[model samples]
Target: MTAQDHHSTDLQRNLTNRHLQLIAIGGAIGTGLFMGSGKTISLAGPSILIIYMIIGTMVFFLMRALGEMLLSNLNYKSFVDMAYDLLGPGVGFYVGWTYWLGWVFVGMADLTAVVSYLTFWLPAGASFSPIDQALISAGCVIFLLLLNLLTVKLFGEVEFWFAIIKIVAIIALIIAGAYMVATHYTSPGGSVASISNIWSHGGMFPNGVNGFLAGFQIAIFAFIGVELVGTTAAETKDPTKNLPKAVNSIPVRVILFYVLSLVVVMSVTPWTEVKADRSPFVELFLMAGIPTAAVIMNLVVLSSVMSSMNSGIFSTSRMMFGLSRDAQAPKMMSFLTKSGVPANGLLFSCACIMGGSLLQYFVPNTIEAFTLAGTLCTILFISVWIIILLCYIRYRKSRPELHTASSFKMPGGVFMSYVVIIFFVFTIGILSLEDDTRRSLVVSPIWLLVLAIGYFGFYKPRIKNQNTPTKKF
Candidate 1:
């Protein structure tokens, strides 16, 4: 079959309002919040709450700009397409591949998180060897791969339920925490739970400016998938209505899921005492005298990691499919299964994700591996977000008519786009304040260099030859 014939089958619009809404919520509530918040609390004290809000506010504005651009043209599948149409093919190629790699890193980090949570279920003296952890990570990847191969609707249904579980768990924790504070319940450590606990230890900024900056590194990772809904635009049933609804709800989800949940946890456990090596969610329930808290919270966090990983697989495959159609990737990646799923791209992404299991043998320490993956994903994601903003700026200048006609306009328009871009630049600067994140920053440019080499040396030349006129003999 010709390349055009191979990609003739288009992705279906099977995702509904409910699916899109929950997917957005699920994306916003990443595993980082559940697993990494403990360390953030420890580093920044109660001020981590403010950090989340600041990040969330900036992200909401970013999403608004993204939503406006996506709505301006229903033909655009994802921000990659928007980048292609507004910026150019070269920029689109870079964004598509970089976004794919970002999700791959996120998948690795999620797998590491799953193994860490599973260890909670083991006996005090028992632990998973490197082989055992690798096997578990492989099994999880295979299971998610099989599920995504079914249909787009199934992916949506799975995310809907996954998001519901996360929402319910956080709500229960918040309610239980409020009751504890009201009743002044005393923990095993003799620390009394009270509203004043948020600031009593050493005031809100107990760890000082450096500590506050340290919190941004992990806290930024927690918000990595917030833009995932933009990827569903092609498969969404009604782009104009559903896309805006999903984007509009981001602020609410951030406040409830990130800010409020952490406030309750710090109030109950005190930020100074929150363990950097463990999940504060599990610890909060354990301190509440819930006998099976570890088991239950472990299960909840395991599901959370799986949810994010599922998202990673779905997004990477879709991105690959898009890139292949644009002739920026291998043609085989664009092939669709009978169910309208990008089967080739899906399998390829899963294969890459399975490689993450090997980190257990090489790194040994799960937290260290997780941190490295998270830092890399954060840097890549920040780059993608910056590109999206740049696309919006280009769109405004080139096609002012579209901006004028946009029903869901970005709040500040071009000015906000520049502001958000500067904020991302500042966040990258914040990553340099720490040793762990700084390493990723140093290694990130190498990926871009490789992309530059691929584009100029290979894809660009091939496209040029294909476009040049041939002489008839």
Candidate 2:
């Protein structure tokens, strides 16, 4: 028996250590890292390795802060809900809806990418067209959403495998790269480019300090969904126990899956050969003389997208469900079907995702929509992180008595939260340095502004006692 057994929260604890672990892992690995890593390498050159490590470490601390606050009070289900309780209903409304929009945009971009990857298996002439692909991708989106709406276990199982597939693939790539590196062989030949591919190009900071700094703009996107684990605490069977294990392992996974993988990639192929708009995973496989590298990588990436879409549905519906129980959102979204599922909320998000099908179908450029969607992801992610920071700061002031009761405390306390907020602000400022990313920088704030308006316009203040007794999270 564990201490969590004797001390359970009000929200129904339905997830296990395994469920929380996979949820965290699934959030950590994304289609972007699989696809956009090549672009990252192109932008920062070899210094991308250092950039990932530093960012991963900082994010680890951020999650730590979140974990402490979440476990600080059992009343907290989703982070936004917690924000509302600790701060006010306004923060919850704004953060919750913004977070939902973030995932919606992320799903749209990922669904489109899935279809684009599916193109590798289709005829070249037919594959290049965006509209046809959107139709099929939309179908895939429906299939995954059904899985989410049907069963919580189904969503968990699917995400488990989705993460495992990405994990296994990254692991395999690392091994293959190690083999090439040991043999002193690679596609592009140069002493510095060979073994020294990581730093020899321009002494690690090839493009200078600013180029490495610029990597954070996109790097933040890869870490966008990492907070999904925090949202899942409501569903975890032993959130107090399992959540800690899952949260603690984030650092290890980030290092093994991201940092180590990038080292092998640049070591085996050299950053010089990596293209601006391509995936390093595909490039590495192709360089290894694997004939179907394109198709195989596509399948893996498609699977990653599907995993995220499924998760997006689950997370948004749960958030809506939490809000509804508190009377912040529409009652329909809160109503659960016989199986205890938020049927209306799930359908609502799916309906929004279906709108993406229209987006991909009618939008003149698939790439532009994808880029805009990516920018939206960065914005929503940063906003949620910021909200968590403010919530923690308030938690310390309002509930100093309960802080000692928490088993897993966010180290460094308010100071850490303040530091992370500044780090995020700096990241946001750097986003404008590039013209392509500048639009996203400008657009993301507008999205948050819209969320702020919705909170004040539509919802009433959350009553303090509204969530007194609730089992569903």
Candidate 3:
């Protein structure tokens, strides 16, 4: 069999360099930057800029480690496959399911965001009730299911256009904000556009150590999908060339889309005046006296959530496919359609997402539901990242020959892996200090316990049968 056939049993390697580039871009930018930045800025003041830089740098290291292993073996599909080979079957199974759960909650959160944004256009009364929103959320889940079922290329195509809209919107906002600052124009809120706004209002770290740490809670979530490009290792064409380029460009995306954009936002308006609940993008345009500021911003924000939800579905289905191939999940999930799409896996993931909408329908308090769900997602995602770092460390020691032979090596090597791992542990410790997020830290252990049970109880028995014979009689 050819290398392509040996590597991908069902998934087609149809995603080109263009698709990989856009997927990387889409993964880096999320609704969190557009909407949640207002709150993060309020929490951390001008210091939020530094917060993004720190997190972005660490994530780039994690991606480098992942890319190294992925390129080490062309037959290896994702981190899931690498974990199976280097860290043993247990690590692979655990990471695979937790990763799926992480994205499932992310999709749930974005689904709620979709409904909330839709309320902007609808009348506030019976036209926008909980039932109405639930139905709309279900419709969105169905739409994503259909889109993903078509083909991997189509999934990449949708993400490409969605990412373009975000890229264009941010570039335009930055330009407008720069102009207002250059002219020293005043906003309707009476705040003047000046670079001094970053430090003038209570200095950079307005909220002190406590507030600076608080910003990490939400800002970290913004970077949740940055590792998504790693998941596309199987479908990507010319992964060696395309994957590294996609991974290396993350630092640029972070600087431009995140740091520069936020600098412009806070510079145009004082950090203290920014509303925690509203999007800074909309507020910035409104400050510049744009006629359709609300409509334009709403459309862009809608696209942001749609992009996130689409990615959530894609990643979750792929994870399920990996899990099933290893016999860690339902065997049916491994079945693929003629187009090389994992239709069963896609359908199962959407079913779970629809359940998120139902939770919103039954639960009267949306904010509480969102907080609990978001916290769980943060915990699970952190675990997945830690697993990737840990697997990289194991790969270095267990397969020294591979490391010595590789062209693209992780910059810091094993020492950097330890540093990143310690950093992640510290972040978890920080999460425990907050009342809102502490519960997730407490609840996450239960998930690990359950995965342990599933691994021993189900997947272990099938491992011997799954592996090939080493010697012929």
Candidate 4:
């Protein structure tokens, strides 16, 4: 390829080790952890800690499988590419568009979240109307679009600082909670802080087995974007070194960010006292007598949501660009700016994301819309992870030489893949146990039916007539 052709077709490798490292951390920590943990704690009490650990372990294994496949063939851009090569073009098209729609839902949730967070700074008894909220959501989408259109490295820098703010907030919470426990600090509610607070509330199983299972419904959504690091493979400076380093640190990130932070919160304010409707992080600071706790945590959580939205924009655009290149999407989506940014894909995704704001007008109840979007996103993400594992199983069997010669092979190989698949099946079963999530489960088939109509009715026939092989990355 000539210089111009190369610039037009290939993504720039501008992301360094630091960028990838923090992006990995940012992907693992979601707004769900900050905003939804209180509800999880309320449902399952101290058992929520064990819930996070279990989900985190399974996610780590999934990432390991993704990392191995990505390294095994550097030509592969993302898991989408792996599916295309190992599976068939039909499955590849489905995975690509399904993953794209999943991020679109996530972007919608984040957009709504940003609007809600902005309302936190309003004066008492003041509020934003639906129109006002929609405008604000549009403004955020435009700002992020402009930033992303600059260059790939700029996106990395944006995520780097955003992830830094999140890390600082969590670390601060953990430190303050530990001090409160050591000093036996007493809140105005007369609840004394102690290590025993976690268990003493209800002997660790206050809500029983049913409550413990219910925790998985929300906790699994907290880890939705954990595979985001794989999306950065094409733009990363050195996949061989950086990818493994990021994947290997999953256990520590889970422990420090999820497990440890929750433990600290419960230890400071007993699980029974954590409010279901509010953020435990903010409540923790409030219990510690920080007058500005609400404002500070509002800012932190706002940044966290934006970081996630930014990742959504970046991932969805890249996936669309890749699909377009393979003739599965519009040709215009494959167009890149001089800086190697996929401007067309970015604009398209931002347009869809703006629909979230419009929901404020139509749906009227933003929380319900957000929940529906989140549930659908969780279902689709789990499906994608399962597809990735199937790709890994195929890789091991068809290319034993690659697996044998590989440096970062998945532990336990195919056996482990089957185990994780069963775990996800159980997780999906858990989703049906709740009304809100079950509603989403029932609605998910409509999307699959749409994909089927597009594929068999339109895409398959078009490709068969062309009689040309799909382009390999």
Q: Which candidate tops lDDT?
A: 1
Q: Candidate 2, residue 291: CA error in Å?
A: 1.8
- How far residue 424's Cα lies from its native spot in candidate 3, in Å, is 1.0
TM per prediction: 0.97, 0.90, 0.94, 0.96
What's the CA RMSD of model 4 in angstroms? 2.0
* Least well predicted 10-residue stretch by lDDT in candidate 4: 360-369
Which residue pairs collide, candidate 3? none
lDDT of 1 by residue, 1-473 (tens): 66546443989999999999999999988889988888788889899999999999899999999999888887788998888777777888899999999999999999888888887778876779999989998999999999999999999999999988888888888898898889998998888888899999999999899999899999999999989998988999988988889888988988898888888898888777888867899988777677586567777887889999999999999999998888888988989877789999999999998988998657757888888999999999999999999998998999899989989999998998899899899999999988888998999999989999999998889989899342111
Per-residue lDDT of model 3, residues 1-473, tens digit only:
54334333677898999989998899889867876687788788999999999999999999999999999888888888877777777787888999999999988877766776676676545245678768888999999899999888999999999999999988887888899899998877677899999999999988999999888877888888888998998999999899999999999999999999999989987888787756777777666566396578789988998999999999999999888877788988987876788878899999998877786687534444555566778778888899899989998988899999998899999999999888887777878767878887787889878988888876776666667332110
Q: What's the candidate order when arranged by decreasing lDDT?
A: 1, 4, 3, 2
What lDDT score belongs to each candidate, Candidate 1 first? 0.89, 0.74, 0.84, 0.87
Model 4 agreement with the true structure over 1-473: per-residue lDDT tens digits:
55447556778899999999999999888867876687788888999999999999999899999999999999999999999899988788889999999999888877766766676677866778888878888888889999999999999999999999999999988888899899999988888999999899788889999999989987888898889999999999989999999999999999999999999999989998897655788778777677586578878988998999999999999998998888788888988888999989999988998888787656545556666787889899999999999999999999899898899989888999999999998998898888978999999989889999988988888889989776665
- Clashes in each model (backbone N, CA, C under 3 Å)? 0, 5, 0, 0
List residue ranges in candidate 2 displaced over 4 A. Answer: 1-12, 122-127, 186-193, 292-294, 362-367, 461-473
Candidate 2 lDDT, 339-416, residue by residue in tens: 557777888888887777776777635545666677767877787888888888888898888677877888788898
Model 1, runs deviating above 4 Å: 1-8, 468-473
TM-score of 2: 0.90
